[model samples]
Target: MIEVKEIEKKYGRKKILKGVSFTANKGEITCLIGLNGVGKTTILNAIMALTPINKGQILIDGEPLKEKTFEKITFIPDAITMLPQMKIAEAMEFMKDFYTCWNQDRATELLGFFRLNKDDRISSLSKGNTAKVNLLLGLALDVDYVLMDEPFSGIDMFSREEIANVFTSHLIENRGVIITTHEIGDIEHLIDKVVLIDNGLVTKEFNAEEARENEGKSVIDVMREVYIG
Candidate 1:
C-alpha cells in the first residue's frame, strides 16, 4: 500500500497541501477527486517526488520512496512529457532506455489498443491521441502502482470512452492505481475507493461499495455532500 501522512507543500510562501493523508491499497483503484487547483495534482506530484514537500512523508509498502522504489510506481502527469519532435516509436525507445520496467510487448499492445501508429510524430497527433500516447507510456511499464493526473481532461467523447474501457480491461487488473481528476463520471463504476479533497485538505475517504450498499450513496452523492453541501 502507498501511505501518505500529513503531507505539506508550499510554493515560496504559499502552501498547497495541508496535512493531507491517505492510503491507496493494492488491487484497488483509489481516486482523488476535487475541484481544479485544490492541490489534487500537487499531491500526486509529491508522491512521485516531482515536487518537494515542506513536511510529511510518503511510503510505499512501509519504505520511503527512492530510485529503486520508482520501479514499482509509475506516474503519468497531466501534460505530455515527451518532446514534440519525437515520433511515437522514438518515445517508446526513450522510455525503454530510462526504465528497466519498460515492457515493449505491453507498449505494442497498447499502441494497437489505442490505434496509435509508431510512425506518427508526437507533434502531429491530435489532443486525444497525445493523451493516448501518454497513457501508453505509463501502462506499458510493469509496475505495481500507476498514478495518473487528469487522464480524461480536454479530450473527445470517443477517446474518453476508450480510456475508460482500459480501466476495466485485464491490462490494469490486480494493480493499484491512484488517479486525480474532476471528471469522475467516466470511472465512477470502476473505482474501488474515493478520497475527497477540498482547499488542500483531505475531507473524506471511504470504500465505494460500502458507500453505496450501506449508505445508499454513489460517488456523485458523496461529492455533493463534500463540495456542495
Candidate 2:
C-alpha cells in the first residue's frame, strides 16, 4: 500500500498541497481528480519524491522513499521524456539500460497493443500516438506501483479509448496505480477509488462503485456537488 499522510507543498509563498492525505492499495486503481491548477499533479510528484514537500510523510509499503524503495515504483508524466530524434525502439533501449525493472516482453506487448511501430521516430507520431509511446515506456516497467499524470488528456477519443482499455487489461493487474485527471467521465467505471480535491484540499475520498451501489450517484454526480456547491 502507498500512504500519504498530511503532505503539503508550496511554491514561493503559495501553498499547493494543503495537508493532503490518501492511501492507494495494490491491485486497485486509485484516481486523484480535480480541476487544473488544483495540485493534482503536485500530489503525484510528492508521492514520487520528484518534488519536496513542506511537511508530512509519504510511505511506500510502510517504508519511506529511498534508493532501495524507489525501485518499487514508477511515475509516467504527462509528456514523453525522450528526445524527438530517437526512434521508438531506441527509447525502449534507453529504459532498458536505466532501470533494472524494465521488461522487454511487456514493452513489446504494449508496442503491439498500441499499434505503434518501433522504427518510427518520436517526432513523426501524432499526438495520440505520442501519448501511447509515453504510456508504453512506463507500463513496461515491472514495478510494484505506477503513478500516472493525466494519461487521457489532450488526445483523440479513439486514442483515449484505447489507453483507457489498458486499465482494464491484465497489464496492470495486482499492482497499485495512482492516476491524476480532471476528466473522469470516461474512466469512472475503471477506477476503484476517487480522491476529490479542491483548493489544494481533499474534499472527498470514496469508493466509486460504493457511491453507486449505496447512494445511486455517478462519480460526476458527486463532483457536481463538490465543485458546484
Q: Which candidate should be chosen as best, given TM-score against the real structure? A: 1
Q: Which consecutive 10 residues in model 2 have the weakest lDDT in total?
A: 67-76
**Candidate 1 residues 35-64, lDDT tens each?**
899999999989988888999999998998
lDDT of 1: 0.93
Superposed Cα deviation of residue 66, candidate 2 (Å): 1.3
lDDT of 2 by residue, 1-229 (tens): 9999999999999999899999999999999999999999999888888899999999999999998665689988998989999999999999999889999999999999999999999999999999999999999999999999999999999999999999999889999999999989789899999999999899999999999999999999999998888
Worst 10 residues of 1 by lDDT: 180-189
**Clashing pairs in model 1, backbone N/Cα/C closer than 3 A:** none
- Clashes per prediction? 0, 0
